[model samples]
Target: MSRARPFPAAATLGILALSACTGPQSALDPAGEDAAEIAGLFWQMLAGAAVIWCLVLGGSVLASWRGRSLWQVATALKVILWAGAVFPTVVLAGLLIHGLRLMPGLRATESDLRIEVVGERFWWRVIYHRDGAPPVTSANEIRLPAGATVEFILSSPDVIHSFWIPPLGGKTDLIPGRTTRQVLRPTKPGVYRGACAEFCGASHALMALTAEVMTPDDFARWLQAEAGPAAVTAGPGPDAFLRHGCAACHTVRGTEANALVGPDLTHLGSRHTVGAGILANSPAAIARFVAHADTLKPEIRMPSYAMLPETELRLLADWLASLR
Candidate 1:
């Protein structure tokens, strides 16, 4: 008895699976829009090659089934070889040229705003360039105008580090005594997550940041507030902020803390992350760092003053928070 032929479901499923494999659109795939276009072009080339392969292989099989002479096999081989060699070369060359043209836009420029970003031991510093010589300072969070051009000039205070903002652009390494730059112009206004792409030291994994893209007016107001002095201080926190010798490593503009060994905390309250984005910019987080800097960040140069009472911690946090 003759056996029944198999159903064509296998071939149909294979085709569908092949189609699904061609579109690359996930976070794990980091090529951005350019990669998708390139993948599409590659799929087209592959489909053309697949068609030739099926035609040649199927013709050879059909010829054998029909009891044609072996010479028909040689003809199919010649057609397959010539078509495979000529078509892919021409098509790939065209794709390469087309891709090269798109490359310039991949590195395109925009007249968006410029923001200078600095990397530190456990935090980040940002300086918005204005018409005059603006004071350099550090904020736990970065705010930018939506649809603005942001050119980050990255440099490290001590060791080498990397800056990465996932939604807007790729990683750029910041080296000591050198400046590296990346430009970004996000169309949407929202928060973007960032981290230190390069391993700096003990606390490398914990260092993270947020990129807050805001409306133009809000950004301007933030700049103005940062340019001004810390809000009026009136409690024990002010005394502690001074007596505790925090100024030796941090500088608050218009204050005596002119130290440059650490970040310029002139606008600390306005920032959202602390210790180089290791922790949130909240009263509890700030108090924890002040009380036990080593527990939160091991081997950190900043010494802990955990002996301070919770009331004092709250006072310090309130004072720092009032700086906005």
Candidate 2:
């Protein structure tokens, strides 16, 4: 028997890289009810297009090869009528109606939780609302309970930005001065990547966030912890933060840093990433961001503290990390 030829290593690598399509950020891998519906619609349309393509193109090739017989001409005309016009009309109309029917059900009748998300220039301002409780404000990351319907009321303080969590729900535009709502029922407990799908401005590519879907009990615990004020400690970090006039733009709960120009840092230590998910939430990463934020994220309004002493920067990173 002849030996089969081995696949090239580069081709194998390419195939392996395609696995990224099904990763946590992929629309092909639906982890929530809304994404599943959208994926289903996409697959159905793709299959229909493939069938139409085969019928139209294959029929044309066959007609050209077969002589100009009356039978061939009649058959080609019939195929053109059905595949080119009738089939497409019927298929598109059906898909349109199916999509319309799916829309109303996608909006959950009863939401287990409500979150107000405001799109800033390059970050997300998240407010978790509770019944008879003060809103818990955070930034760049959203935590939700798996297997629960959560409603997001989205708006923009500046320009338009689209909120899209591929594995969770569809894209919803955050229009300034207008509130848009989207409902998501995440079925899996994992971190889903989200970003601004619309082109806002400079650093729009860096405008990303993480959606942490946890079990109901764990979500409750996290919510409680986030609802409280920032953890106070006897450290130089808080002093350094204040001394540098960081309070003029950012806010850390239970302190005098109540400026609304930037993101809330009350639970910054607990977040998975910093600088709008541009960096991992580590001491070194935090220190680098605090010292040279503009270098990492250009055009950001937060000024760089590259002149600060290394010791003070380290203390500031440690203090922020200790908030958890």
Candidate 3:
């Protein structure tokens, strides 16, 4: 026995009233090559609803305009049973199948590069694994070869967090003691922003990261530079970095500080933002972050270094920025 109820004309009008909730224009909309296919299937579901709404509302207007009695609602009900209920169910089920069919492509199977992103209270540590080579580590920055499948294994050292890159895909949770993997193939060459979707603690707002998708050749060059050790500490930039005990918590390749407690600053100079992802990767921003990090993000494990003179802070920031 069929138990489906016919939808009313008013129901169709109600869906149209909510049509504004559909996909709105935004910079955050993932516009990757694969995104079109994803978006197409999504909008098809929306279109099905819109079409049903139009038919129901239009049929109501036609029925009323034809001098039919409002009591003839039974006839309208019969039409809705055929068009609204029977029709939409078929349409929606088909759309669901179509959307689900794209899942295999989302999951990678080819030779994909593996990168592990670890989220903490106020920072992100990105570790890239290369074949037959040592791991490359950096803070709040990730670079990948365009058109390659980069599988990101996400985890949190402490609390729960979420890794979200709007232009790439959606957010994936980073749970402590568990690894969540997200695979993304970069089709476009550009810098993409990411953030911690879930609030972990006081510095949650400041925790952010960036994905720098580049040409295969450009990515190769970056990897080469990262594999090398820091340049000679002859200048005031490297001099101040060492003399000030900055290496105590941070690590630069071939330097004394190899502690994994904090993010590796080997390539800090190449990043676009500092203090996690709260501020732009500029000299002033870096200086401000290193100086007032504790105040800017209260309860941060890092101590305030603002007691240093502005001139020394500027020099340190400049030297760090020159790292890349």
What C-alpha lDDT values do all the predictions have?
A: 0.70, 0.89, 0.77
Q: What alpha-carbon RMSD in Å does predicted model 3 have with respect to the real structure?
A: 8.8
Candidate 3 local accuracy as lDDT? 0.77
After superposition, candidate 1 runs with Cα above 4 Å error: 1-110, 233-235
Model 1 compared with the native: what TM-score? Answer: 0.69
Model with the higher lDDT, candidate 2 or 3: 2
Off by over 4 Å in 2: 1-18, 70-76
lDDT of 2 by residue, 15-102 (tens): 9887876986899898899999998988888898898788778877876887577366678789679877998799879988999999
Q: What are the TM-scores, per candidate, against the unseen true structure?
A: 0.69, 0.93, 0.80
- Provide the global lDDT of candidate 2 against the true structure: 0.89
How far off is residue 58 in model 3, in Å? 4.5
Models, CA RMSD each? 7.6, 2.6, 8.8
Point out where model 3 deviates above 4 Å: 1-31, 53-85, 232-239, 242-245
Candidates 1 and 3, the one with greater TM-score: 3
Supply candidate 2's per-residue lDDT for 283. Answer: 87
lDDT (Cα, tens digit) per residue for candidate 3, span 175-294: 999998877776777877778889899878777777788899999998888888765445787668777888778887766656677778777777887887678788898898889889
Candidate 1 per-residue lDDT over residues 196-231, each given as its tens digit = 889888888767777777788887887777777666
